[model samples]
Target: MAAVGIAVVLGLAALLPTAALPCGALQPDNTTASKLLGTWLYVAGAAQFPQHLLELLLIANGHLQVEPGAGEQELPVPQRVAVGDQCLTNNSTYFEIAVGNTTLVKHAKTHQTVGTLMNLSSEDVLLIQYQLQRERTYLGLYLYARNLNVSTERREELERYAKCLGLSEEIVYAPWKTELCQVRDIEKGNSPCREPAAVVTASPPPGTHRPGSAGN
Candidate 1:
């Protein structure tokens, strides 16, 4: 039972922006500015029936990183790319959660609502603290900073939750790509290395030779 805070301390953002955002968006809305930096925590792993495994991914600086799961024991925390107050518009996932600066770190940034905050579709990232007309009805969305250990706890909880929610492991796109894994998968294996599409010539001993091995 290593304290999860160890992960937080390691993930701390050493580079805190002296002044976040461009000179342009400055005014009174710099609140969300502090929310920008730091490596966001994401699902370390997930639990799906019949699959018997799960993982969580973190995305930052154009890099998608992943944390593996602890087998069927428990899923780790849920963490991901949508950890700003930018009101990310449009995206999809099996489910979403809302958490903030953990006992580990703090959120010092803030942002403003640039457009309609609601009606977020698959492409919408609900990461903004919205200003709404209460009577009129509105849901303020805030991009959350979740625990890195969420996947494990989530898996443990969901085992019983799925039954309560009337949910099944038969979720479509269950094994979605974590940002890191996606990058890794594309990087592995040469697609056509087993056989080259085109071959020119090779140095050989007179006539007996290998294709490119000098004996071609």
Candidate 2:
């Protein structure tokens, strides 16, 4: 069984495209920025890199709450994800809207990820093509929606978009069976499902403001 699993992984890695294909970009503007506000549930994801694909496989379900930050260009994103039996929460990362509809997210001041909003057929769905740099470049696509129940047509659309980006058709969907972390519990710092060791909290940079603060 172990050998078969390794073989399957290696086969998938070999199928990855060496270079990413061109895809339509969503121009960043006030209208687009406003659309990003509020809560979004993680529906599905696809990736060109094997490591990122593995990361997507681990997420059973997740959601993100976006709020306006101190600056107009900054968006504070509070994220919660369920992995296996553990729930992980992070409230420090911020997404900055950059030129060309691209968003920059800094993770613990360690590695920066650049994500470009992609044009999707459905207005209710948001598709982001992202590239993360660490030792090497990793490319992936994230699909978020206002509601958790996604249609079959939407899933098909995502598969087509993934193919256009030179990513394999094997998209991973977060199971809806898992309950999302409650906002009230998160605010009170007493979520029942939250794993103590998995909790990640950090202060915003000196000039920035945290979500739900008066400065926001």
Candidate 3:
């Protein structure tokens, strides 16, 4: 976990700016900034989801990065990418997500609201809803823990949220079985990638590739 923290912090610093304004109307609100600064594991999603299974994603310092996973039942190895994020307005209800690497990683830029749920209910409990559009689109509502383990009550809370959203049982699954996953430190000992000077103005809506690859 300590390693995860160090890696996440470094990644955020290397990739994100203080305030990212993709559109001229976007603002720098700290409400979402305060709530979204930490590591989030991918616990569950809609059926036919596209993100890497067992993947741990971190949101910090107004940036987003991928914690590479050990792959799922079929995926042998998973790839990752870094992202820059910012609030859409002062209210912090909406956020913008852009790919850190355009050539190496696929960018999800077709939509403006990459993150729907960013509030932290407790120190350890974070409930979020986002959309993923690959060839097809799917909604991902996830419960994230600050650490690897969460209370049973917290788990139930996530389930309740899933049910409330009308997510089917078969589509929802917790990818983490043990403690926090052992993930690749994407920011450790690597040359800092070039940060985008201005936010991307054209692309498809933000979406992630499936469990095996980082997207086409």
Candidate 4:
């Protein structure tokens, strides 16, 4: 019985992290988006994995979600956020994501499905943008930023959030930056034959996995 008890404790220990992790930001539009939400990534100029960033695509109605690359999905994961701005139901009240020195505000009474604004484009496409502040962020890690256009009245709020976090719209010419580069194939130790995505950031949440690793 004692042995069985120990095993059960261990099991819970392993699961506790995941269980305790907030499904997402407990509050709406406070922290990040829902883990169950869709996310777009920017590819590096070469072919690196860690150099990927958020793209300008938007996930609707919570159909898609963000999960670790490999099944290696570990415990103690960051709580997925559920809210955006104040009115958006999906927005979380967790970490206050700031862009450009402004904190996006939630509407007094409204819920806009469109997420953070990434940029202004005619493509009619919505994507989330990732960003980092050189002054605030560490040399290795970067704070994830959202860059969705949000075509509704919520556009201003979304942009405010972007500015608060020091994140800006994905510029056509500018690309994401990171410490890693797509030098070798990362897998076979060879060079990449073709170019990867134009934007450079990290994959599977930067620092989560390395390029070529089973996670990547």
Which run of 10 residues does model 3 get worst, by summed lDDT? 1-10
Please say which candidate is ahead in TM-score: 2 or 3: 2
Candidates sorted by lDDT, descending order?
Answer: 2, 3, 4, 1
Q: Say which prediction, candidate 2 or candidate 3, comes out ahead on lDDT.
A: 2
Clashing pairs in 2: none
Model 3 Cα lDDT, one tens digit per residue, 107-148: 223223333443334655555554333333444455555564
lDDT of 4 by residue, 1-216 (tens): 000000011111111122222112122232233332333222211111222222111111111123332222211122111111110111111122333322221211221111122333322222332222222221111122224333444344334433444444332211333222222222233322222222112222211111222211
**Candidate 3: RMSD to truth:** 14.9
Question: What lDDT would each prediction earn against the true structure?
Answer: 0.21, 0.58, 0.31, 0.22
Candidate 2 Cα errors over 4 Å, as ranges: 1-21, 49-54, 98-111, 180-216
lDDT of 2 by residue, 66-91 (tens): 78878667787766766555555565
- For candidate 2, the lDDT comes to 0.58
User: What's the lDDT for residue 143 in model 4?
Assistant: 21
Instruction: Give the better candidate number (1 or 4) by lDDT.
Output: 4
My TM-score estimates for the predictions, one after another, are 0.19, 0.68, 0.42, 0.24
Writing each residue's lDDT as its tens digit, candidate 1 over 1-216 gives 111101111112232232321112112122222333232322222122222121111112111111222331111221222211110111110111122211111111211121111111212122221122212322111222223233443344433333332334332112223232232332342111122221211100001111122111
Candidate 1, overall lDDT? Answer: 0.21
